[model samples]
Target: MTSVPDERFPLPEGFGPGSVWADRTGHRTLVGRTQRGVEIPIGHGEGEVNPGELLKLALIGCAGMSSDVNLSRRLGDDFAMRLWAHGTSDEADNRYLSIAEEVQLPLEGLTEKEIATVVKVFGRAVAAGCTVERSVVPGIEVTHRVLGAETDAPEEQA
Candidate 1:
């Protein structure tokens, strides 16, 4: 497992900003080391999944998990959750065309007002807590570096 970048979660308490370990092949499992150095396994489905899609899935999954825990704790009942997100972008300039997420949260037992409140709260929390979602906000500084097999940092610096 490779650690996600700082742009993701602020490196949980025990995990470092970017610390992860993963099995080389078969049964994909990526263990992230929190800042506190606790090894937490990241769950994944058993199938041929694209690494690119997994990046987006991470954010969605985290938000879904967070909402589930929070709502369950507050309401004291397990609620059904359905989350779907899709985004389009231009490959050349990496410009986003559109990004949309639909969260279907069932509050069958709760009152209407309570349902509204839950949606608002959950939306805010996911907006702030979801790393991929957060990254879409403008003005975030990011740098990309390319390193070649024969590149020498010291020489390049000169």
Candidate 2:
């Protein structure tokens, strides 16, 4: 992947709440950890969530959680639902061009009108409350600076 600096991107003030970091544990592998002791396996290996999957989940997962209140008001509190997110990658840019989500739920016993209302409510709730979705829609600045680099290292510094 290649990167180009965009000065228009905002420079964030400080780290957000909580501590999150990753450690190299193997070849092309990393173990991401949270301040609360949650460990997420991140790598290209055939295991758990990698970086790309994590990004997609952040989008769909936020939608599901935010829409839960509206969906539960229409469907029962215990209604079953499944959400999946996929991204269309732009190979030339090495980034996702777009993302689409498919939500499956038990809509049996409800009228056609009621079903439509439920779907509309779900969408509206997500649009209003899903932070990740809102951020991606308008785009957000993501800046990276490699830590532990020496001034006299092999590569040039920014």
Candidate 3:
């Protein structure tokens, strides 16, 4: 498969490394730390968000963040926006096939021209500039490395 090209973009400062670790509770709990030392707990149990859910959230969050910037510029600071994202996956293979996002705006007092402008700008922003959505659609490269050696082995019985 052909690899995607690397392109650099300017990002705001304060972005740094984040990490996640399996918790010791033995209940598939994970703890995450942000670059600025904020702790986030992720659990895979009742009333918790699992890894798959987090992936979907990342897409929606990026879409909202990126689109909102452009939308706000066009629709003014008083406009309100909401978004919903849904994904379909093949259960047997655990593969996602598609994702759809709906954008909603409260356009009660807006003119027809204003509504049209808002829709056009928001759609363009989400389609072209949503970083997470763009990245996932084209796929990203991943590399893995091992840092430790095995310490024990049991003898085989014939």
Candidate 4:
């Protein structure tokens, strides 16, 4: 177990989002609320969004969104983009061996040199500020703990 903090860190209230998971029928589903309080169903079934899939999604989503913002600023809002992320995990050892992301952009009007420049700028911006990409590139330290009793409370009482 990780050591308990002796003093609370100074942080803004509700700094991070929250999620709720429940068993729906036989499938496990995860739901989260947006900042506007709109519920979003993330995934269902064991295989739908297992840990590895979630990891890949976080990487791709973060990079895609960040790059989209940068690209829109540079190329205006008329361009289209597609991003894909892939990774190989050694489940037996519980580690990821490699992870890669590919981005496709429709640069219909730009010259080869301009396209290259845009790619370079996007790469630099993503490396600097994409939260998920930065977290995974060097990896992050995860700490967990068990709370409450082993058995869940009744739904009516919960």
CA deviation > 4 Å runs, candidate 3: 1-25, 139-158
Q: What digit string (tens of lDDT, one per residue) describes model 4 on residues 1-158?
A: 22221234443454554422223333456554344444445464543455667777777677677667778876788877676666667789788866666666766777767766666666766766678767766663221111121222211100
**Model 1's TM-score against the true structure:** 0.50
For TM-score, the strongest prediction is 2
Give the poorly placed runs of model 2, Cα more than 4 Å off.
Answer: 1-16, 140-158
RMSD of every candidate to native, in Å, equals 16.1, 16.5, 18.9, 16.5
lDDT of 2 by residue, 1-158 (tens): 22222245443455355546677778888888665667789997778677879988887788789889888987889988777776656789888766667677787777767766766676677777888777776553221111121221211111
Query: In model 4, how many backbone clashes occur?
Result: 0
C-alpha lDDT score of every prediction, in listed order: 0.50, 0.66, 0.55, 0.56
lDDT, model 4, position 14: 44
Question: Could you arrange the candidates by TM-score from highest to lowest?
Answer: 2, 3, 4, 1
The alpha-carbon lDDT assigned to residue 99 of candidate 1 equals: 45
Measured on C-alpha atoms, candidate 1 has an lDDT of 0.50
lDDT of 1 by residue, 49-88 (tens): 4443555465567667656666676556766666665664
Number of the top lDDT candidate = 2
TM-score on alpha carbons, each prediction: 0.50, 0.74, 0.64, 0.61
What is the alpha-carbon lDDT of model 4 when measured against the actual structure?
Answer: 0.56
Q: Is candidate 1 or candidate 4 better by TM-score?
A: 4
Full candidate order by lDDT, most accurate first: 2, 4, 3, 1
